[model samples]
Target: MPHFNSAHTQVFQNGELTLGLMTPFGDATHDLADMEDQFRLAAMADELGFKALWVRDVPLMVPQGSANTASNLDDPFIWLAGIAGVTKRIALGTAAAVLTLRNPIHLAKTALSMDRLSKGRFILGLGSGDRPAEFAAFNEDPETRAAVYREHWKLLRSALSSSDEQRSVLRSATGGFDLMSKPASDIPMIVVGTSRQSLQWIAEHADAWATYHREDARQQGRIGLWRLSLEQKGASLNKPFIQSIQLELSSDPDTATEPLELGLRTGRNGLNRYLAGLKTMGVSHVILNLTLKQRNAGEIIEEIGQYVIPRFPP
Candidate 1:
């Protein structure tokens, strides 16, 4: 069995739920010309006891819609490295790095470098990627993404593994070349979304699984299916389930939950209750993407740190 690193342990525990924040912090309309303030808020989140900080991967600016506007304009690895420099204890991660577009060897090397820089406080969340334009841009076929994902995933794992047996296998496959550096510690790979693969595949490979927020009934059913898949594979069933929410936090602490496209508009109390319910249903972590239109991101982080996080203590 692989040992859990600091990042994994900080954000995940069996039968408990922790909170995380997405990067590009502050108002959605805020200027991105300067990342200084963003780094400052990230440090504040670390000080305020947020468990992990997540960054997204968007290689291209193909606009999806009004609802899916891309805010993560920077490269995921470089962005997390910067975050690692500013924050002390808060774990850093890619919300979902597009696996099929990049070479597995390069991706693994960058991930290992980030892990070392963060002092074992890095989690790698990977996805197969869905955008057709992105696939075309990379000169990859969208139709073959599933096969590509499985192939690259194996290579990436081999590159990241410290075991001589695994490295030998990789060398044999790659015509005698070797990846020189190894991770400082076991870096947890959280498979984000379905990744165009089966639940069984994810259960067999991923250290954890992350998905976007869904309705309670659907989400619970998904978790049950994940557990069943693990059981079928005869693997440990304690792997965590992570979810992301696009939150528009209301100032009124007791305001009721109103559903948005991918998340909710709720006050601190409502958010706490919702997270408690998710925890009971087997979610291990919730990544909050603040969609604040009125309040400052710092204020909401403080409010959540004071009220919501205590109810689901990390």
Candidate 2:
């Protein structure tokens, strides 16, 4: 097993699909996660042997977009911090944090703080900003976002590594400085999407690759593409692939898969089969969003724990 961090070890099992829960545990009837209940759900997930608990960085809401726009109204760092206090064992991750919108120094400090709080369970997933509102509001040029993304990544990596011989300096958009409190363990970074960078760049930088769920054959193609990119770069094949899916689990164990918003409505049997397919395609982790479910979050989680989890056994 890789010894980088608890999160890395928990997520990658060589040939298995480790399950994770995305925050705001239940269905979102009000366009927001139930903040009151989220703490409880997070604790349950941790206690129930879930591999990870994922959160997203939605700094601002773009009101003019689709109906699926987020309204959770919580900071990712704050939420993860709270969950860290309440839970043990389950890895805490950012489904992704928008690196282009924040100061790299502050991001590094905050990420290290969270890693410390969680005892090295933090996975700092990064992405180039996608929303126009976010880019405009932050005065960041979208065309140069990819370059900025790479710069931020390089600075963070340097900040986190040991430089006992000499101090490490990081240059940001405005100024240059050294970040403090490097994490005790290497915080695993998983790049979400292409982030307007090449696969070769991703292979060179990211500890893992995280992408949206695709159909089986297409997903396999992506896995093949990732492996080929790594092979070309002489990179380690130990890098894991992560994918997220929205789930609406059914009561009937034999329920067939039906399309839903960015995921599927399926029973445990169907969910197991889908996960098995992903595992076979070299996917190491599956972060499941329960924000579109028809069943109770606790009930669904309990059922998954009882049946599906044993089959995968993260």
lDDT, each prediction: 0.86, 0.81
Alpha-carbon runs more than 4 Å astray in model 2: 1-3, 27-32, 64-68, 162-178
- Residue-level lDDT tens digits of model 1 in 75-99: 7788888889999999999989999
Q: Provide the lowest-lDDT 10-residue window in model 2.
A: 165-174
Model 1, residue 34: distance off in Å is: 3.1
RMSD of 1: 1.7
Q: lDDT of model 2 at residue 242?
A: 87
